[model samples]
Target: MSSDLCGSRLFLALPDDILTIITSSFSPGDLCNLGLTCPGLDSFMSSHKVWLFQCDKLGLVPYTTLIEWRKGVFSYKALCRFLVNIQPMIGTWVHRNPELRHVVYVMPGFLSVVGCRIIPQEIGPLGLEDGPILWTPVFEILCNHVGSTSFFLHGKERGVDYVYPGLLKSVDRDCNVLLLEVEHRHQRGGGKLADLKNFTHEADNEVSSSQRIVGRKWTEKPFICLESDDRELLLEFVTSQVRDIVPDAANVLLFPRPRIDAVDSQQDFIVLHERRLLLLQMYERGNMNHDLKSDEGSPLNPTELGSSEISKSVDCTCNYPASQAAETKEFYSCKHWPYMYESLSAFYKFPIRAPKACDEEYAGLWGGTFGLPPSADKPGKPLFLIYISYEESEGKQQMIANKILDGKSRLSPFNGSTMFIVNIDEPSMTIFPWNTDQQSNPISVMQSFKGEGICYWSRHRYPSIEPGSLFVLENGLLVYLWEHAREVLTLKRLYLGELLKRGERLPSFPPVLNFAHLTS
Candidate 1:
């Protein structure tokens, strides 16, 4: 029997380690077929070691982290499932708004993945690699033991750090977009359960005092907690205000606010309203999904149906005082207020176009100059260079226009830079203001503004007194126009180092604001 087994053509005849490496070479789609060949082969193929190797090959996370992450998950196979699904999100993502070149680097964070934005900064001498990437906390997806995820957004204001919690939506293996949306959680689970539990316990203890005041108005009634219907009504009211503030808004209904009717006094109402406003603005500033320029590569709108289903599970029935309930409602409402506006509830869909994949036509280094139109008294002003690339994030293909400072040009270098992420399929992109109190939807720059030059380019009309757009010309040259085309910069594709060499250098931000300092 031993001789027969030894002479047989059996895959198990090879050593385990060697067999595992060989199995790892097969595509994941082929693993099931290989496993079904025989019981012995199935057992061998299903081994954790083989899947562990597969996970390592993905290179999204380190082997040590994968090993540690394994302890929290069911098996190496499940761990591999998580890693592959999140691989597309591990690269660099940028936005055209904010004029700060906000670059989001999605990396491994503990048992989950984190998307950290390199704060808008001035370019430093070290350049991209050696320069310390000073990044601020943006959003993170915390994985559960079962590989499910929860989303949390980070915010800082007045020296205080706040975590705006939400949930993961439409996250599948092929999902291209990562939507951190405000969802009502019926079950207390994940990393944030403890903090919520503690808050609930504290609410219970404080309810006695506030109940005395609230009991007087509703002694006869049961005084039930605010229901989903109540919150929906309040959300409708808030959304109406949002529409009034920004007429022709496209995705204003993305935020689902909860009604905090527990406000017993005028002070509570003021405090809660103030808190709500601040949280909503912060979420509006951070939630960039609606403003994304591309969606052609996206599979489906996962949030389309899932948001209502999950929001239905939201139960604010904690046994807290009226004031506490109000505060809690405010808290939950704010979660969706800021970043929750993911176009999940958008009535109108933005235009789509065939993507220009990061090919040679328009996906490399570009240099230009910005000045008044040639017809203007001063046609040439500042020498500018831009880096154009095709990037994918949240399941969309974007034409990213990133501004770079030129040190070799005759003009002094600019202090700040701008990045514009445009959808390849659509002829338009949104332009956001640098600093403004108004919460405006992205202004479409789909229309072309023809200038006196030999080239023709498209520009958008902005509400601001001074409007600008990254105008791409019929020629190879790219232009940046500001102040209604009064200031324009024409750029031709060139090497960044050469442009910096021939360009005059200027002072940039401090180490923290510049890429000189790295954040842990």
Candidate 2:
């Protein structure tokens, strides 16, 4: 064990096969250091078997899939380099927004890793054990042939899907932040999106002469050509090009879409103009560290909706606070939509099973407390006891939410009824609470709702609503909310028997009866 024994020539004389077998258990860092110790060890470290072992140990993908993935990279070592860098991100991630049950499962994509959002929905009649979990794509970090990472965000605007491409920042081994910057091209010849700025004025002249923008003013357009006289023509020309790619360009521009005639034909061009301007903002943010507050206002005003008086509104400033503004003006801002954030839940200790079906990840007893919102200014914290399970109704699968204890009023336990139809392929679910006396037609308005239940799952945080809504966090905390109330329940999976042994129980239900039906 001492240096005397390590320095012995016999140690280095060990056969290559034996050395590889021993180093097989070594981590990537350990193997790299071992190779540095001597020329013999270095030669053995390069064996495909040694690197292959590391790749398998990473467990990011199947061994066979890793093998195929390696074919696209420089070598097994390079693949390991890529896998190791993104390894920390290969687990559960959460955000405290929309409903707390907005869970994002990071899993393997084609030579990349995707962050998918698990939309909260009803567990159909199939119960939790055999239902599907609806999910949507949020963001993806792909490894290039050279092993560098490129980030792409999936989103929809006006129902048109688009991928906002950007570069991933260097992730620290213990990274606690996920900062996604929109793609930009502030510098000359920067991003791919920025290059589209070169669309010629000749094209603009043809479009403007053929179909002049109907109601937009010249000042409202982005700064295009250097010459004031030529800027409008250049801007219109670029708009034509953008219309080809993004069909819905009304609000896709850096400024509001020009109130123009023949919009269908020129929609892409306008969107292209806006897209380029957004890239410029991204470029400015990246290079200058521009404050998000500085770029807060949208290009259009409330009254500018369809105004041909753009010149009149160009000099005006908005009265709204930057912090409270929506993200319509940001580059590739559609990624902020909640529903588009779902990803395939293939990578986790316990990923959600097929839609509507409950699995170990979320099927268990959970306990938590609910505190009234600060704005409520009312005193008193309430205990929220909920049991979520998969059950069958008639012949279809159903996800049921049973309220056992309402800390405020414990007398009424919710009579089990179908809350949401178990769906596995979407991020949000629509609640269909039937009339107590009728078989069809869910309650007309959510405000008049008396039964505490979830409605639709939105990608954005719905902080305005209260109890009965559910959200999940990345650290494995399940958040449930009540209607029109700020009080919340933060729950963690617990052994009901153990909790009962420790003296936890509902007022009316015995310990055995409390969580007894969870397994059924």
Candidate 3:
């Protein structure tokens, strides 16, 4: 026989188990390439047993978990596809404004990926990880039984939790921002569905060929600044679907905090799996029945569909309207609001990563409180989560401080309001406000810049920008002094994700409060 024929015969003669073992060493790319060489290798590569190994080897899930998950997916290959597709998005995600509230930790959920926001809190006597972390559902990217993924935004309206369904614009492999906005999809006339399928991509391609039909308008942006009443109504329309109640029993953490091994979290995966299935059902039923109302759950004229659908949608998902003409834009578009930027999409890209040890040094998340630094002898002040970013106005580089979260009162500076702005190029020649800090140590100044800070016309009254000095303390503290009021704001750089991981948990608010925080 010819050498090539002999080699083919030898390869085909190997036992299935041995051949599968040999093929296991090949990378997914190599295996795919090998499959194209011949019918036998193609058949060998497609084996369920082969992919079961691949799925386990992929490390997204354990072998035992993979076996259980295999029951839900189309195939092990599809499960692997899902795992590989979502791997990049499994880390942490955050936003600048609404400070402490915008830090969302994205992790694996049953058969989906869930984004959970860490609630602002103080450490309890229980100490760190010993305390349960308080979190509320933000959004979930769920996979259907057929392995198709769906995006659902959770909120509450008038004491009821609801899920808003929308199409994914894109899941950037290196996406830094997670935005919620309405996409105006204008499908083309006479475009064949077959043409759409032809362009069907692998998983995580939220904008599909069906979405990108011939002659279709390409408006793949969501960071829109909503200001007018019509804009809020338009945003409301995006999230106004599928009313349901979130169960109290479902108020468990993404991973149980009490256990070090995450044993409980893994076991609860089945619960999340069921919850995911229920959310998918509610989404399907809501899509089928536009006027989906349930009294037991969401408000706005409730009806009786299935008794348990709403609670299952988000475990404890609180459904609320995504409307706040002013803050509505903040939730999706992260631009310095009220001021219309040249490009709605371009402005949302803040925290452009300026260098350290310079005027641009004061960039990123910070934790601050009014008054002197904390003393064990005295209780600490309310934690203010601040987002510091840089921008250029007219000609000079300016640093903007926007408060995204206020542990004290939501109305003080308003969510997404700029707390201060400093001209990076202009250093203040003024003397330090205090020669001593809280500890009475000589306050060494690293750098100082002239700036403007938010000071109310009266305590908790009208806000006004007052002359201030932004000080970079030698000890790595940022203290802003409003010269007119003689007010001092002290801040320390924060590692929020670490805090969330170590923070304690509290009882979740009802769906309306948990999801949207629009309730008392």
> Top model by lDDT, which number?
3
lDDT, candidate 2, residue 33? 88
Write candidate 3's Cα lDDT for 379-406 as tens digits.
3345666778888889989888887666
State, as a TM-score between 0 and 1, how close model 2 is to the true structure: 0.40
Provide the TM-score for each candidate, comma-separated.
0.40, 0.40, 0.54
Candidate 1 structure quality by residue, lDDT tens digits, 9-101: 356888987887777778765776877877877787789888888889988666865775676668887777667656655544433222343
RMSD of 2: 20.6
The clash numbers for all candidates, in the given order, read 31, 60, 26
**TM-score leader:** 3
Each model's C-alpha lDDT? 0.40, 0.39, 0.55
Better of 1 and 2 by TM-score: 1
Candidate 3: C-alpha RMSD after superposition: 11.6
- The local lDDT score (0 to 100) that residue 370 gets in candidate 1 is 38
